[model samples]
Target: MNFLTDELDYEECDKEINKNDINYFRNIWLAYDDFWHKNKYDKSKYKYVKTAPRSPNTKYGKINDFYRRCYLILETNEYYYPLDNYIKIKKRKRTLTNLEHIIIKNSGNGKRQSDVQDIVKNAKFSKTYMTNVMKNAVIGVEKIKEKKILLPNEKLFVNMDDCFISSLFNNKKQKNRIRTISANKGTDLEKSTKSRNVLKDKKITYMKTKNGERIKRQELIDKIYDFLDLQFIYNKSSLVFIGDGAPWIKTSAKKENIPYVIDRHHAFKALKKGFIFNRKVDNKKLTNAYNLFINGKYYLLLDFLKVNNIDEKIYKYFKNNKEGIINQKENWNQGVCAESDVSHLVKSLKGYGAKIYNDKVLNNLLLINSARINKLNLLL
Candidate 1:
């Protein structure tokens, strides 16, 4: 198992030795290396040899380095041959230490397996090894317990959002959406949303196809609730769900009877998109309308829109999300930043779509990345 040697003492040598002489000796040693012979002997040598039952000595009786071969140690070129009889000849099981596994996991920060392998060149980390580590880490995460419980009558603010990433299966491109939930305790929505403190807990789940059939929306909802339950705040604490005005999100909120707040960013973006190219409304009017919305003047905003002859679609967009908009204006100063959160949580899945051909591994990667972002221990 030795992978190093002491420096040679040229001054004390009886005969002059140079690099060429060392190479010659190395070649000779390599040719007779017992470890290599025991592991790499030609099996064909015994193809024609017949042996009796319970024979004491067979033609090819040497034990093979099965563990090394199975674990990919044999594939590495950096192994150094130990001096003859320097150590006892015993079978050593090749295995990765916890630290080494952590290294492999860290090396996979948003990079493809090939790139990760290149980063950990000494280990020769294979796709199989990385996948197994991630799989195990995800399994370990399931055993984690939520120690923090919400106080009675406490209020919890939760943000839910979905981000899409491209998936390739059998060379056909598909789309997968990852849903994330971030929850924290706060009494004042505006102050809590504006604070820089990290959320107390965060989790991610994704919709992926199984057996060539996509998962049902109910299954996705169940997964989200499971995550919420794990946080120990499913129904105990007053929960407020905040997100962009997506139908699926609104439906989920309504199903749970949780109050939903439309994110200010999305509302403002809709307004800008509605009037960005309209020549009828000038910049002053647009600014005025935004101010009115931000100032909780919903009726005034509607009046301004109607008086300015803005598009009916723009008028309807505000009118429909009026309650959510007013809630944001009155309570949440910064509003929800689920879009930014999604970008951070799923950055690894983007731009590396082609490498992630398997849906299972992609989901596992999301779990691992989310755990890392939440500062959870990934070592298992």
Candidate 2:
């Protein structure tokens, strides 16, 4: 123990002490000590401890014997076993090629799945087979969902966003078929706990599916609650969701009794584009639209669009989300970046010319990529 703790000096020690080592000498002393005290030492106890070697060795040799004893103890689950009867368990065998290891490593590095097959050398397997193996490796690992609050009294800032997957190999006939991809990421209200800063350990979840039917607003709400429940992340009083001012999101927030805010980025982008698209004479309509949107007078803006013979789609959308948009106060810190999360986690599956529809495979890969990004055990 002294040597292990760097408290021992080698040169000053006697030759006899260096050869037999302290552990060996201590064991012999212990045996004699026990026999003298009890008049009959337990022989079984010595079986668990190493028998002194025929030839004396240095401390390193004694250390090996110590490790061997530890392994036996672990294998037998702390039960007494004869030294000769200890079994050495064989490791699970595998013959992974260079290509297989490379593929798995690439996925862990955020490489595109379609591009992974290109890195395989010798071309021993078909492209589809290689792709399947890579996907399977990802799916074989357990799903991960964990959260950590880094600071005391820190609130949870949650954000949700949506994307679409437009291509599926088997659904070629449906040219416009798209799967809705919804994602959510969260962090503590502590300034240092931003998503980018905590990329390796952020809270994230995803749900993507296509059934040709409009997803009910309640379904999305239920999913949000389910995700939080599965990850064991819940604190309604200290939780707030940031969304893109979608009617469904707002409605769901109301139902769940949680506060939500309009994403400033998306809101400003829509206001600018809609103002340009709905231009009026002398920039009159454009200026009014801008003023109303910035001031959160979405209902008045919709009326102005209607009276001026303009399509009310843009203003109507703003009106439906008036509660969230109007409640977006100046002090509210908005750091939800669900869109980028999709780009990082689902980029490979949704790459150009890549067709995917199997929710099982996509969901599995999503979990694996999420785990890898957070520096968790990929196989877990």
Can you give the TM-score per candidate against the true fold? 0.60, 0.55
lDDT of 1 at 164: 65
Kindly list the per-residue Cα lDDT of model 2 for residues 1-380, writing each as its tens digit: 23222222333333555576566544533343333325422444432443422222232222223222211244444533221121111122121233344555554235555556455432334456545554455334455545543333444556676666543445352322222223233333354443344422255566655546577787776676675655545466666667777666677778878777777667656655664642534366567765665565657766766666553676666667776656554244444544556566666555512365344345555666666654566441
How far is 356's C-alpha from truth in model 2 (Å)? 4.8
Full-model lDDT, candidate 2:
0.49
What's the number of clashes in each of the models? Answer: 0, 1
Give every collision pair in model 1: none
Against the true structure, candidate 1 reaches a TM-score of: 0.60
Off by over 4 Å in 2: 1-101, 108-110, 113-126, 135-146, 150-153, 166-201, 213-219, 230-234, 277-311, 352-364, 373-375
- Extract clashing residue pairs from model 2: 200-374
Error of 2 at 110 (Å): 6.0
List lDDT for all candidates, in order. 0.54, 0.49
